[model samples]
Target chain A: MFKIFDHTADIGIEAFGETLEEAFEETARGMFAIITDGSKIEKKEKRKIEIPFEGDEEILLVDWLSELIYIHDVETLVFGDFDVKINDVLTAYAYGEKYDRNKHKYGVEIKAVTYHMLEIKRNKKGVTIKVLFDI
Target chain B: MWNGPLIKIDEYRYKIPESYKGKGNNLKMRVPAIIYASEEMLPSIKKDDAPEQTANVATLPGIIEKSMAMPDIHWGYGFPIGGVAATDAEEGVISPGGVGFDINCGVRLVRTNLSIEDLDRKKIKELVDELFRNVPSGVGSKAKVRLNMSQLEDVLHMGAKWAIENGYGWEEDLEYLEENGCMEIADASHVSEKAKERGKSQVGSLGAGNHFLEIQKVAEVFDKDSAKVYGIKEGQIVVMIHTGSRGCGHQICTDHLRVLENAVKKYNISLPDRQLACAPVKSREGENYFKAMACAANFAWANRQMIVHWVRQSFENVLKMSAEEIGMHIVYDVCHNIAKLEEHEVNGKKMMMYVHRKGATRSFGKSRKEIPSKYRNVGQPVLIPGDMGTESYLLRGTDEAEETFGSTCHGAGRVMSRAEAKRRWRGQEIARNLERKGIYAHAASWSVMAEENPDAYKDVSQVVNSAHGAGLSLKVARMIPLGVVKG
Candidate 1:
């Protein structure tokens, strides 16, 4: 499932999902889609990163985004994909990377993520995450 | 949730009707609700559900005139973040959330003789480091000033005056403080012993979450005359202490909210939000809460006073100069989260009313005798602090402020929630990033650091701009943060 929604003044995100891993991937694609038009970027580089959290879903979610924020700040990279695997003990191994401005065009700058509408609801078939961003 | 009538007042102001009576709205609202904002800001205001909160506040038992919101309005728990409502003294109701959990959470301005250029970046860095060490910060941070039960009561009742008598601050400082550093009616007996104990050792300490001790340099002066009168100049160093009554205030609000929640049903007062639970001003519950909340407010004033003393000490210890030699003096202190009894024009008659300002500051204009004599001619100085990386502002109340019950926006209200900020950013790296930007942040924990990130707040410039644009306040000077010590 993929959907685009307006968050605030100048931000729009496209939420995507097929699997749990696919959902995380979709969140990043959605973020870049909001930040810049990600359709312009070709799949240039694939980077691998591992994130460990206490065996809790909430902390896992926090750690995942903290990692992304670190990458964005330090390397000025906006990842377009999230291929996450939740292994034993709630560890998440994810791979993705830098969104080239030349390759990917986007819209309003996302200052930060907010917990206003944050949720990860699990149904019989799968899970869905609702997140709000500050633009 | 209720959309009452939209009463068009003027270009910059509008009102919501008082017709939503007996429908969970509490006020016997005599007048419509008033909101100040531009067309651009209105969408965000509506998004936060602020209008509903304002309308709900308007429905309070004895609310006088409109439940007012400033241009920087945003959605907040019970009362909208920038909401202000004044109710008749005998019939008005008081709610904890209206004053917030942090009672008397306020801002104080301090001026120094030295210009910003006199303190090199290295000196400023040292000053900030010293402040971080000297002023205990973060969650549950203790203070050097320990007090017994009796001494705690003294602080509670005396407020900043207690600090002065104890040699923590100077007597002259009292003049610059709101209520002379004391709210006279704060009965120590009204404050629970538990609240007293929690506050006993917390004085002179900076509490956590959006609370800070900042060193700022004035960068712009918008009103030359007012700036001169305020002793503010371009490149001048000033300190802004922003915190509140800490655990004492929080416990007081918690305790009272429980009491009010029970009494509201007894009083047959209906409210849209339980957070808006209140009791009539004449009721015992209401009186007790007011006295107790006043004690908390005084405790907060004392807390900030003691912190200001330590801030001076930090400057003295780090700079190797006596505080007297450095000419460190408080400019003014103003409370944001509070409800106070004041006289206002109600139905063409001067009536005593309980003014509830949750995330709003008093912006009394010139000629309001309540303002200090020094500023009586220029209006009260309204201090608005921005984020760690940006500039804060010094504004003065304008004559137009009377239309909004002498109120203004408190600070750059949060744009992001804590959980979301933590999710989006790493504390350690964020600290490092700030360092690269020539800004240093000393926080007790990362949890708090992420919550108070610059992006977590609205553009304070926009907030101040809206305030000035609306004539509620006039900008005096802009101060850029030199360093931040957060708790």
Candidate 2:
């Protein structure tokens, strides 16, 4: 599950999953939801990304989102779904196609992923993550 | 949320003494923090964690004097949006958060002899549409011109000079830009291949979120002599472009911020926020980030230069007059988000300092060689762009601005979030509202119209008036928009 939260001058995302990886994926979905304004983005193209993971999970989360933002800015692609695996390294397949402003409904631009109030909390039931974007 | 001790110093000044942070934490600030604001703005100023960020900035090592904020302050990443801080050249540190993600995110104003009487409402709409077609804007917009890696490097180095040399603009245009649109210290070699790849196609495009191109008319003139010196008069048409270094700057900030975040551990520096990452100016990491950041700053200058060229073309195409014939000359350009090495007098002794202005404009008074020679007697022109459907200001810098290190407010700082603004107003309704106000508007996405509804921002006139009252900058003239093209 994922949800969007608001700040006075910025916005953030809160996501939840049974595992840490699931939570990261849900957070990515939450970010794209802001980009596409919750419009349907078909998985016509698939792009793979790899990250040399660091020991710090928080830094890894920022790196993950930053890498995605780089791809979106350069390739003009928006993803609705992401498949992921994590060990000592992170590799993922992001599923989406070139963003069509008419079809996808253009939304806010995410300049960079910020570490402000970033979190990864694990409760007995599930894992939850929160992140903010500097738009 | 940030309920801290805010001592009212005067009608336009407030202070947060160094003792407010208390003695409990290891991150004791070295100096006090001062904010320039009016009494009426205190409630909304304290409405967020902005003042807390202002105080956090005071903790940086080697920060000189007081960490200051302009009246348009708002909660931003590591620093408040309208924050200004100067540090000793030898002992200080440079933080990407102080410079912002969009390095050299600045404003450029173009003046024309044409007046409101020369064009009717239909012509204004046509010109606005022409600009929308000529300029690539909105989320993830690409530039019209493609550059190879070698060419992009020259752009990263030469800035607006490269654009003018490549036939993008006129030869005389360089004189009006801050730093002549190029920082000679810029070394593109420090920029990453990833940043280069991102910048390869996005040079001239205007990115989304509060960035725009507006066709405005001089609505008011407060100082006749200064306005005359700047060649601005009531009823005259002028164009203003608001944008910055796009993806290239963001990547540079992100890349360096990561290294600096680690440098904090390497150098054993303690800070309140991870985002306020920095390294000493003398350190290898700090030097490299500054050089790479200079490249991004140059990139933004070239980006604005190219847009100015196209803006001229769009005007010519619509008005059927050569740009030169229209007397469309640049007034002046200023970078609100940047860190520059400058010389200032401190306690009767001159010292070099790196002045970081995040969402702030330099308000240098008369006789500063850093400004253009044409206006040496009148001081530099400071451009403050208001939100859409509001009145933007043309102000003059004053030596009195030295109180804030010669810096002033940037614009109408955000009082509400985009999400809330979108939730409250529909895009179509906002467009209709603008039409009722006789303003022609176009956006890449209508949803952006709702997201940037004019009501979402503080009254820019109020902010400008505070700056004027505080003696940071003096009001010269005001410009109201007739047509707007939003990214």
Candidate 3:
């Protein structure tokens, strides 16, 4: 599950899941939802993204979202769902379609993911993380 | 309320003494934190974390004199918007947060000989509509001018000079630009391939958010001499373009920030917030970020210059007049978000410092030789734009601004969140109200219109008054928008 929070000049996201991978996926979904309605984005295309990590989960999270932003900009894709796997390297399979202004309802443009108040933690129930975006 | 210890220095100045440090687990600060705001503006400013952000800035290493926030301060990521801090060039640090994501996000004003009496409401509406078509705006707006890899690299290095070389603007336009529209330190080699890819097609686009192209009329002149020097007369028409480097700058900042995040650990720099990640000024990471940042700044200068050309074309198309006949010439351009190596007197000794102005303008007084020869006797032109339906001001820098490293307010700071503004006002209602007031607004969507309601911002007139009263900048003229095209 994921939820959006209000920031005075930007936006924030809080995602929770049964595992870190699930949390990452939820966060990705939440970020896309902020850009446009996720329900409207069809999973007609799939792209794979891999990011190498050195055990810093916080930086890894930022990289994950940044990759998605780059893909969105270059390929004009609006992702609706994400399947992520975490290990020494994290891999994500993003599913969505090209953004069509007439079909996609536009929201605030997310410029980049920020480290402001960025966090990732695990407890008995699940893992939860919060992130802020510069818009 | 801030809940922090604040000392009233004067009616327009407040200080959080260096002894105050911070609340709870915050670090000790090297300098005091000063904020320029009148008592009337304090309540709105205190409602957010801007004051805390300003105080946190004081904790940065080698911060000289004081960490300061202008009268238009607002809560922003890492550094508070409208914040200014200068650090020792040899021993201090450099942070991307100090410059914000939109590198060199600035404003440019152009004056025309045409007066309001010469334009009818129908002609004004047609001109605005033409501009809306000419300028690519809104979210993900692509540019009509696409550059190849080599041409894109040229833009990163040459800035507005490249635009003029390509017939995008007049040769004399470069004189009125800050830094001649190109910082010498810009190295395209340091900018990433991804940044170039994003920039190639975004050179002439007016990116979304507060970015806009507006037609305004000089409504009032406070200083006849200064206004005359700026070539702005009451009731004369003028154009203002507000934008930055677009996605390219955003990507560059993002890429460098990751490197700096690791650099912080390598350099063992401690900070109260992770968003304040930085590296020593002389470090490899720091220099690389500066180089890439300079490239982005150049890109922004070129971007605005291209838009100026388009605006000129739009006016000519609608009015059937030549550029010379229209008397459209640049008044001045100023960067609001940037970090530059500048010389200033610190402790009575002239020294070079890395002055970081996140959402502040460089308000150099008359003594500075960097200003154009045309207005050297007066000072740098400080352009402060208001919201879509409010009044903007043109001010001249003052020698007193040397106390704050020659910086002043950027715009009418936001008092409400986009969500809050959207909740409070409907887009249609806001548009209707602006239309009723004779201001034609062409926004991409109603939500954008509502999110940028003039009421959602602090009164710009009051903000300018506070800055003028504090002697940071002196008022020259006031402008009210006749039409606005927002992204």
Report the C-alpha lDDT of model 1 over B1-487, residue by residue, as the tens digit: 3344556566567777777453444545556788876656665566556787787787678877778987767776578778898888987787776887778989999999989768887998899999998888753367877888888888878888888888888889999887887888888777776577677778777766678888988988988999988888898999999988877786677667767867988999877666787899989999999999989888888888888888899999888999988889899999989999987775568778888998898898997888889888899899888887787899999778877778888888766555577568877888888888777777766655665678877888878888887788989999988788987
Evaluated with TM-score, which candidate comes out highest?
Answer: 2
Q: Rank the candidates by TM-score, best first.
A: 2, 3, 1
Interface RMSD of 2: 0.9
Point out where model 1 deviates above 4 Å: A1-135, B1-11, B19-30
lDDT of 1 at B447: 53
Per residue, candidate 3 scores C-alpha lDDT tens digits across B1-487 of: 5778879999999998888756664558889999999999988888888988999899888788999999999998889999999999999999999999999999999999999998988999999999999999887788989899999999999999999999999999999999999998989888999999999989999988888999999999999999999998999999999999899999999999999999989999888878888899999999999999999999999999999999999999999998778999999999999999999998789999999999999999999989999898899999999889998999999888999899999999888777688789998898889989999998887778888899888899989999999999999999999999988
**B-chain TM-score for every candidate:** 0.95, 0.99, 0.99
Task: List CA RMSD, all candidates.
Answer: 11.2, 1.1, 1.2
Candidates 1 onward: DockQ, in order? 0.02, 0.83, 0.65
In model 2, the clashing pairs are none
Cα lDDT tens digits for candidate 1, A1-135: 545564222233335455666666666667666554556644455556676545655446544654554345334455555567776533443344454434453223343443334566666767666665543
Candidate 3 overall Cα lDDT vs. reference?
A: 0.91
Give lDDT per model, in order.
0.75, 0.92, 0.91
Q: Candidates ranked by DockQ, best first?
A: 2, 3, 1
What's candidate 1's DockQ score? Answer: 0.02
| Candidate 3 wrong stretches, greater than 4 Å | none
Clashes of 3: 0
- DockQ, candidate 2, vs. native dimer: 0.83
Q: Which ten residues in a row have the lowest lDDT in candidate 2 chain B?
A: B20-29
Worst 10 residues of 1 chain B by lDDT: B20-29
